[model samples]
Target: MTQKYRNYDPEFKLYVVKLMELDGHKMTDLSQKLDIPYGNLKRWKTEYRDQKKKEEKEAQNQLLTASEYKEMYEKEKKSNVELQEEVDILKKAMHIFNQEK
Candidate 1:
């Protein structure tokens, strides 16, 4: 007979990752305490780290620094604000027309 594994939520996984990062609990200790497989926990830790690095690299490629991001964000936000104001004005005009009917 095969043993069953339980599903862990995002919070649970995050907790485990924190413990692993802290290095206060050994992998086997965590496995015993959490009733998770030690090998799986190790794999998850490595995958989490690799994913974080990949995401940071992607963010860097997309936007490098805070000032650069703020500049781009401000420009984009200004354009969006103009578009939204135009939309609101059109909506109000449409409402006035509708009410006049």
Candidate 2:
């Protein structure tokens, strides 16, 4: 006779890990209560922590540093001033041409 093992989905596995975290439950206690193997619960917790760290690293990568943001703002301000100066010059030239005509 062969024993059948049940497969748990990712969401369920995450939930199980969270239960231990949120409730401060011991792994052995949770394992017995949930009827899951202790080793499986331990592995799930490890994987969840690793995944969260990876996600946090990725998020950090997507964020600009303070210096970077300041530099970008300065560049944009300079570009805006240059554009306004060009517009002013064009307006003066247009006025001068209209007066001559």
Candidate 3:
């Protein structure tokens, strides 16, 4: 008699791994309970960890660094000050022109 091999989907594998983690079950115990090989379960656990790390790195890359934010803030502040100065000069000129009329 030959034993049948089982195929598991990615979602199922991740679910099993998460179940083990949440229940704090040992690989040997979980393998016996779920009818899976201990080595396969271990491999799935490792793959999940690597996937999480990759996702975290990608998320970090999407955010701006502290220095970059500071540089942007400084540029906006300078622009605002220059605009205020121009407005002030225009107001003074208008007042002088009105006085001469």
Clashing residue pairs in all predictions, respectively, total 0, 0, 0
Candidate 2 wrongly placed segments (more than 4 Å): 74-101
Q: How high a TM-score does candidate 3 get?
A: 0.61
Model 2, 45: alpha-carbon shift in Å?
0.1
Prediction RMSDs, each to the true structure: 7.2, 5.5, 6.7
Question: By summed lDDT, which 10 consecutive residues of candidate 3 come out lowest?
Answer: 18-27
Greater lDDT among 1 and 3 belongs to: 3
Reference-based lDDT, each prediction: 0.87, 0.94, 0.92
lDDT of 2 by residue, 5-76 (tens): 889999999899998878788999989898999989999999999999999999999999999999999999
Best-to-worst TM-score order? 2, 3, 1
Model 2 residue 15 distance off true place after TM-score fit, in angstroms: 1.0
Which residue pairs collide in model 2, if any?
none
**Backbone clashes in model 1:** 0
**Which tens-of-lDDT digit does each residue in 1-101 have in candidate 1?**
99897788878887898798876778888899888998889887998899899999998798558898799899999999999999999999999999998
Rate residue 42 of model 1 by lDDT.
89
TM-score of each: 0.55, 0.64, 0.61
Residue 64 lDDT in candidate 1: 50
